[model samples]
Each structure stands twice: as structure tokens, then as C-alpha cells.
Target: MSYKSHTVLLIPGIFDRGSSLLRMQRALAEEGFDAHYIHLRYNSGWHGMEHLSSQLMAKIEKLVKKETTCTLVGFSMGGIVARYYLQAMSGINRVHKFISIASPHYGSYWAHFLPYKGGKQLRVGSEFLRGLNQSVRVLEATEPVSIWTKYDVTIMPHSSAKLEIGTSYEVPVILHRLMPMSSKVISLLKKEVITGMG
Candidate 1:
């Protein structure tokens, strides 16, 4: 598919408003790509990840039924949610590239700080995260990329952001929330988006 025909679906992190990804969306649009931000109502992690992923699939289905498969851009919890859609809900066939920014692929210790059903699920060694890792063991069709910072305070052990199955990039940024908006990060992402279309 040509880069012009490519679409990007951006998902925000847990408890984060979709507007958090506004800068990235606008950057993508300005680059001549059809970029869209997904607004998830149940922002708390308390809801089932798969349930949320299904909701995302519904929105994805509505957007690219006949068009080229989209590139999935997920930040933090949003990355995990997008992974659930890909690994558990057969989303690989619908997406050409998968980019995760500062997501906890291996459960985070900081998750224990939050007191919600979703937080419990994200805690280190939670059944949900285990299941997610198991599903990723068999992932196919789409190429996955993980982007993270060495100084992230949100995802403790920061290393938890790294993935074992696909490409991973460790950046020098200091905060987790700024991953999506960083110009350096955006440059890397733009390259991935264009490369994945091939």
C-alpha cells in the first residue's frame, strides 16, 4: 500500500483522555496520513482488556472495511489494549504495523498503586498480563514495535516496556507521558509507519 493510503489509529493510555494524543494525531495528519484518535469511554483499567479490545475492533471495523489495513499506535495501557485486539481478537490481519509506546508488556509494579479492577489486572504477575503474554507467543501477520524511555516513572522497572517477541527501542526521554509527543519519538514513528506500509 502507498503511504498516502495508509491509516493510523492512535489509542491513549489508562485513565488518559484521547486528547493526550492530539499532538501526535495532528503531526500524522500534517504528514499527509489519515490519522484518527480513538476515544475510549472506560478509561479506567478496571474493565476487561479483551472487552475493551473488542470495542476498539468495532471502531476499527467501521473505519477500514475496504481500505488498507491500518497501523496501530498505542500508548501505555492503550498499547496493551491494542495487543489484546491483535493477539486475542484476530487484529493482526487488520493491522500492518503495531507500535506501542511505554506500555507494560510484562505487568508493572506501579500498577499496585492504583486501586481499581484494571489496576489489579495490571499488577505484576496478574493473570491478565500472563494471558496477554501467552497470546503474544503465537502472534503473526503484523510486525510489532515497542518504544520506551529509560526514565519512565509511570511504568516501574521501565524495562517492563520492552517486548520479547518483536522490535523494541529504548529512548532517552525522562517521562512516560511525553513519549507520544516527543519530536524524536515522532520521527521514529513516522519511519515505522512508512516502512510498515511496504
Candidate 2:
């Protein structure tokens, strides 16, 4: 596909008021690329990970048409949600590039306090995470990229942000929430977006 046809779909973290990723969306748009920030109906994920992913699939189906794929930019819980769409919802066949920022791919200690169904899934060693990890190779064709910070407190063991598959970048950003807005992170993301268009 041509670079002009490249579309980026950005998914925000859990419990978003729906504007958490506006800055990232604008950055992509300012770069002259087509980008959309997808808001989840159940952002708090009170239902569960599967339910959140189902919502993601529906939004993606509306945005991406047959024979055309888009790059996905997911932050925090949104990253895992996007992955469920890719790994389990057959989204891998439709998505070419996967970029996750400050996501807890390996589950997070912070989730221990979350009592919601979706929150429970984010806890360390949850069945949901283990299942996703087991089938992560499904994303090999997409050459996933994970961006994280060494100082993230939201995701305990900060190393949990690093993916076991594909490329991972550890930026010097100070916080997890800042990953999507940091200039350094955005610059690298721009490069990744442009490169995959080839």
C-alpha cells in the first residue's frame, strides 16, 4: 500500500473520558497522516477484556475496509485490548503494524487493587494475560513495537512494559502516562509509521 493510504488508529487507556489520546492523534495528523482516536464505549472495562476487545473490533471494522489495513497505536490497557483484537479476533490479518505505549503486556501489580472484571484480568498472572502471551506469535507478521519507560510506577517492575516479541524501546521518559505525549516517543513512532508504509 502507498504511504498516502496509511491510516493510524489510536486506542486510549482504561477508564478514559475519551480524550486521553488527543495529543497523540494530533501529532499524527500534523505529520500529514490519516489518524483517528477510537473511544471505547466501555473504557473502564467493567465487562472484561474480551468485551473491551469486542468493542475495539467493532470500531476497527467500521474504520478499516476489506483489502485495506491500518497501523494501531494503543496506550496502556488499550494496547492489550488491541492485541486481543489482533491475536484472537483475526485482526492480525487486517493490521500491519502494532505499536503499544507504556502497556503492561505482562500484567501489572497496580491491577491487584482493581476489583472489576477487566481490572482483574490486568493483574499479574491473570489467566487472560497468560493466554495472550501464549499466542503472541500470532503478531509476528505485524512486527509489533513496544515503547516504555524505566520509571513507570503504574506498571510495577517497569520491565513488564517490555514485550517478549518484536522490537521494544525504552525511552527516558519519567512516567507511564507521558509516553504517548513525549516528543522522543512520538519521533520514534513517526519513524515506525513511515517505515512500515514501505
Candidate 3:
């Protein structure tokens, strides 16, 4: 059977290994979308978001060479990584759709508890956040979708996951890490990607 022209890449949250996104990848495959996950060089929170974003960009570059279109499904910190590549690194041209699940687009209060460049960047009002916010318009070139849970405990003030330029959804899933595994989130993500293709 001929596959869809687009491929979906899954970026996992901070400290999460690439394998953590297996459930998401499987869901996308079942929906007839080619899905893959990147093995981030650094899974720790010690590096800056830019560092992680660079790795993600490399994967996107390689994938786009084979597929006509690409979609990014970032989980938690993975969303931030994709944003950096899209907003700061001029990745909008490479991506057709962006889906953020439980990400901290507006910065999270708990980020201050960690002592690392990446962690600090997640704190509210960080320079990284300032730059990301300023380039929010870049996302307009591609479809953006923000999926978050109201009961997330990790991203305090979970509303930080919402984006100004995209459609937002709130799920009843209580745990932050379980978002990708939630069928509701996966279904929404598939709908967005397919709709964007149309």
C-alpha cells in the first residue's frame, strides 16, 4: 500500500528517552502515518533547549529529504525543542504541522527548581522564553496545535502549554507524563495532522 506523503516525528520531554515516545509512534502508525522518534544526544536537562533543538532539526532535515512533508509531535520539553527549531532556527519551512502535548510554551514555575541551562530556560521569564515568544509568528506558516491536560502537576499553571496562534485542547488525563499514551490526545493529534494535509 502507498503510504502518506507526510511523516510524523516524536520528540520526548526532558529526561525522557526516545523510547518513551513508542506509544505515540505506534498510534500514528496505526492511523496510517509514518512515525519516528529521534534519539536525542543528551537526554539530561543539563544542556540548553537550543542544543536539543539542533538535534531535532538534524532529524527533520534527514526525514524531509525522503518525505515530502513532516509533522512534529513534541511531548512536554520536546515541544519546546521543536519550537526553538521552528521559531529560532527557521524550521517552519520544513514542518507542515506542529503538535505540542503538555509543553510549557509560556514557561513553568517548577523549572526554577532545577539547576541547569535547559531547566533554567523553562522558568518563567527566561531569555529563551522571551525570544521564543517574540518569534511566535513564525508558527503561522505551519499549522500549530497545543494539547495539554488541566491536571498536569509538573507544569504548574498548566495553561502555560497553550499557544496564542494555535487551536488548544484540554484533556481530562490527570498525569502529565501519560499524555502521549492517552488515546484522546493521540486521536486529536492524528486529526490535526490529517486536516493540515488537506
Which candidate has the highest lDDT of all? 2
Number of colliding residue pairs in each model: 2, 0, 0
Worst 10 residues of 1 by lDDT: 1-10
Error of 2 at 32 (Å): 2.4
Better lDDT candidate (1, 2): 2
Return the top candidate by TM-score. Answer: 2
lDDT of 2 by residue, 1-198 (tens): 522257898989987754767777788889887898887868887888788788778877787776788899889998999999999888887788999999989999999888989889998899999999999999888889999998999988798888899999999999777778899999989989888787
Which residue pairs does candidate 2 place in steric collision? none
Question: If the candidates were sorted by their TM-score against the true structure, best first, what order would they fall in?
Answer: 2, 3, 1
State, as a TM-score between 0 and 1, how close model 2 is to the true structure. 0.95
User: What is the C-alpha lDDT profile of model 3 across 57-176, one tens digit per residue?
Assistant: 888778766436588888998999999999888787778888999999989998998889988999988998889999898898677899998899898888899898879999999898
TM-score to true structure, per model: 0.93, 0.95, 0.94
> Per-residue error at 144 for model 2, in Å?
0.5
